[model samples]
Target: MQAWDDIINIAMIGTDKKQPDTISVPASLAEITTRIITGSEKNREEQFLQLASLLYNYQRCGISPLKKETAGTAAPVEEKKYCSTHAALALRDVLQDDNHSLLQYWLERCDSRTQIAPARFVPALLINGERNKKLRLLISSCVGKRGEWLSGFNTAWDFSAKQTQEEIWQTGSLEERQEVLQQTLVTDPLKAREWIRQTWQQEDAATKLVLLSILAPFADESDIDFLEGLSKEKSKKLQLFALESLRTIPGSPIVLMYESFLRSAVTIQKETSMLGFSKKNTLQCKLPDAVSEDLYKTGIDKLSSDKTWTDDEYVVFQVMQYVPPSFWEKTFQLSAEALLELFEKTDTGKKLLPALTKAAANFRDRNWANVIAQRRSVFQKELLPLLPLAPRDSYINHFFAKNINDVMDYAKETDEPWSMEMTRLILREAAKKPYPYVGFFQKVIAQIPVAVSTELSSYPVSEDQYSRSLWSGMSEEISRTLAIKNQINNAFTI
Candidate 1:
């Protein structure tokens, strides 16, 4: 090792700067090194290269095999039957194409029938599951005993392995620990909190941030004290994250303070019509000339990033983002529709409506989402997920003709199977603009239900030559994917 280190130093200094005669080799390799350098009439650089090559080979060849423990016992007999050959072939195609949605559908169907993945595909499934957390549980269900057995050898797949949750929490990698934290949070949040509390001091800042995020969705009144303590952390990002988590808890001190501030800063006033028969509610925002110390401590920024809006407008925007949209409804004593109507008519609406839309999304307020979706100027595609199935489909149906690209964006967000009516609508529209949007269609092929395969078959051919070529190719791909999906479904049934 010392000889190799000397050779490395000589190499780093270069032959011109340090003579090749300075090179050293292990006792066993010394003879070969001398032979390589002695009779060679080569210059110092060539001699150095030769000696370096010899030492590198000697070091590599001398490496001792790592002393690992005994090979584990053979995998146990699988309780579940392997999937049918056709189903395995379908899985192979999905994997080969790297089509995640279809892969999920395949795993779901296989698990529904209580069949394990083919032995050959278990490793690939486990590897994919390692990268995609959403697929891990599904993969665990369908990969069955062999996959589970294989997981024991690769710690990366420990989520599917038979290790106890406590064991994984203590010894697993960061990802595995986070997964365990999430599962424990769902089953026993108190225990999860205790674990984080015990390890809080030992974790680095980044790890603490991740652990805090894992607690966000499951955060409750019990977590308020812990989160409030973290809100005072020196790390700005960690402190901000803790504050954000507290905002999600309804009665947390931060939320109560935010509510108290907003209660005075924003108010609704009633206005009478000229005839004095009808009344309208107007949103009146009165931000402080300066952001108070208390408000600033709650993480409200003092300046507006948007050049068009003043600092005060931006401050109000940040406040609205944290408070649930329902707060506006309760405070104003108006329906979501009426409150939206008020926000839209005011000069302040420009800044507040976006924040309101964001709050609707953040708080998962369906009523506010629906009302906001009705305003064409303010609606965002991000709101699609908040709408229930019937309303979402209706929204898409209403807007699909003018906003084909938007519908494509929504398809990318979700893996839910399309209804027959929506399927027909999308297919008909996609055929009309097959050049670009058809490519988007190819990605979402799994979302098209199998029942629509018949419609794909009966689809009319285009009259134009160019359009015909594109549709023909698109139609064949759709048909083939549907046929494979059908085969996968039938294989599981049998």
Candidate 2:
């Protein structure tokens, strides 16, 4: 070890500046170190390399094992039943495939059936739960007494161990601490806020970002002042994050301010036809001459990053993105459909349309989502999840023929099981153009209902050799995944 330390010091000082003759090895290693240094005719760099390699191996190979201790008490007997063999095998397949959604479904089924994972699978599941904090609670519930007992031996698996929330908050890993904060937020948000407030200054930047993110979903009037305070912090990222979180809270002062600004900055201009029979409404956007101190304080920038829009248009876009689409509807006294129509006619509409679309998705305004879906524009794919099942399915089906890739994207994003009709449509499209859809087949495979697995064989095969090969592989994977899912479903049947 002394020789190793001396070698490091020499290396740090550089071979040219210091020689390797100064290395001091233990009596046991001295002979080997001397031979390595003088074994051949070499320069200072070569002598240092030989000495470093010799001491490195000596230290590594000489490491002493800890004194053995007797094993602790045995794990307590588990009252819970083990999952079915079929279910365990399905789980193994899911785990090996690294399919998170399937794993979630399996855990849910295992927990709901009052069965714990097989003892052999407990470690893997616990390891997964450690990596993905969201799964820890579910995994803890399903891993049973044995898993908890196993977790006692490994510090990384401490999430499965019995510990008070306060203990976990103080001493747990970042993931574990986050899980605790998330749970605390649900049970006692004020306490959670207090905890973050107490530690705000001490936490690192990364920790601060994650902890602040956890507050977003549970953010309310209580968090407004704290978030507003964060919005003014020196870190631009934290400032933007705080502002975004504040935007989610409907009546937050920042959102109210944005709404107020937009109410004046944007408006509807109505015009009657020459015959006075028809009326028309156009969106009128009044650009601000300069960015105000109030706007800058709320994290809005003065300059435009977007080449297409001016600084004013970009500022308006940024402000409108935070204000809920419902605000525009209420301010202008128009339906979502009518509003979209007006936005379509305006020169500023291109910049603001995307903003309104984002606001609809962010606020989860279903009415706005419905109107946005009607256009079948770029925004439709983003808002597909917010649309009702019937409309979403209809939209995908209508657009499938013209643009299969877009339909695939919509399906992948929603991650919802396609209707039987839509499934048939997908198969028909794949049969025609198997190449484009092949890559996405595995991703959407689980979304295919089990009943449709039987229909895979009936689809027409592509004539092109490359396309046929792709379809064959994709169809087989779909069948296999569906079969496993079916087995998982049936294994849980009472």
Candidate 3:
């Protein structure tokens, strides 16, 4: 230890200015550090290497007491079977990069089979969790109790939220406690809400909003009282969140409040265009010159006329936002499918699609969700969370088939592995698309499962100008990703 400390002191000043003198060492290590420490006195890099070798000697010789309590045998191994050595390697590759959706492929497999991640994976996973917040739950499931216990010792790995729920909740940092709440919300939303209420007064405005936002999906009548109280707050964000919370709960008072507004403000009065012309019957939205105090009090932001939407159009949107999409079915006298078509046709439907999309996602409206999801022209990855956890890759697959960006977007949304068909298409697209596609493919290639690499290479690209120019920059990136994947496969081959 003394010799190790001496090397460290000299290294701190660096060899550029300071060099280690001949130092005595243990009779055994004297020969070892002499050889290691002798020749590399030229520069700081050399001194650093010499010092590291000496420290390794100290570490090798220094063993803490065996009697010191072992991390009481790993938390009971999960009943789930351990994945095959091969699957674990695939997972290691997935976790090595930001492939949350691909990682889900492993997580869901373990979940479906009641399997656990091999214990060897916990250290790397713990590091992965530090950088990507999304990985923690999946990591927790795979690592089970063993990873939870292991994470606390390494500062880099310590953020794993699988253990010490109470200890972390009470004493961990704000982010830590928030993670506990998210996990708890999944298992016990009421409990999470009560916990939020217990500490509600202490959290800052941002934290309070986040806490409230957590209640979005599972929120019920049980949440209404607290959320309604928040809706009355002065801050617009707090008020909006409260309104959103209320909106998620079907037929909550806030929903009814908006429903009543729509009842009074909207009508289907039929009228003929000019005399003896075809009827101009349609959904008509009316707004009073002034809204009731109660309506304003309930956190409805009054609309100022805009060029795109009349005051009536804007008010109708706010009203529909709180009203459940199902309510629109009755109000408009149209089925969910019909309503989606209507949104495509009418000026008002276009205005209302954004509001309806939020409702469709939040209220878990299956029919509207399907229609809106299919109709969505661009990626709405956020909705993936609100939808069912089961594989929706078939739906995402349609989008991925159409655009390269879609390939990038949906892969991050769920844990489902790419279908063989999707893999073929991506390979074909990558082979033909020009240089700009190179940048996106390079990052995403690491995410492609190793199982696909053999097939990926088998694809035959035409020697056309576009394809040639495309693969020039792109193939190298793809090759790099595949090489790393091979390394992971080889390293973990047991």
Name the runs in model 3 displaced over 4 angstroms.
1-168, 171-179, 231-236, 272-280, 293-305, 332-334, 337-359, 371-411, 414-494
Q: Which stretches of candidate 1 lie over 4 Å from their true place?
A: 1-74, 84-86, 92-101, 112-114, 118-161, 183-191, 272-279, 288-291, 302-312, 375-377, 396-415, 418-479
> What's the CA error at residue 7 for candidate 1, in Å?
15
When summed lDDT is taken over every stretch of 10 residues in candidate 3, the lowest stretch is 385-394
Ranking by lDDT: 2, 1, 3
Candidate ranking under TM-score, highest first, comes to 2, 1, 3
Question: Per-residue alpha-carbon lDDT of model 1 for 1-494, expressed as tens digits?
Answer: 77778778887887777665534455777677777678558877787788878778878998997653534567778888898888888888888867676788889888878888888999999999998876776788788787887776777886677567787788767877897898899898888889999989999999999998888877888988988898567799998888888877777777777787788888878899999999977777887455459878776888887898877678888888778888877887888877788888888876688888877776767887887776654556767877877677777777777877777777776757776767777788767767776666556767888888777757665678998888878888888777777877777776
Each candidate: RMSD: 6.2, 6.4, 7.8
Better of 1 and 2 by lDDT: 2
Query: What local lDDT does model 3 show for residue 347?
Result: 64
- Candidate lDDT values, in order: 0.78, 0.79, 0.66
TM values, all candidates:
0.70, 0.72, 0.62
Q: Residue 110 lDDT in model 3?
A: 62
lDDT of 1: 0.78
Instruction: Indicate which candidate wins on TM-score.
Output: 2
Report the C-alpha lDDT of model 2 over 1-494, residue by residue, as the tens digit.
66677888987889878777634678876676677677667776877887788778878898997642434678888889999888988898988877666787788889987889988899999999878877887788888898889887787787887667888788877887898899899998888989999889989888999999988877777888888888557788898898788887888887888887887788777789999999887777776555358877766887887787877778888888788888976887878887788788877886688888888877878888887877755444667778887777777776666767666776676646777877888887786678777557566666778898888878988789988888878888778887778878887883
Candidate 3 lDDT, tens digit per residue, 78-140?
656787777777776766665554455456556555667788887777776777665565666
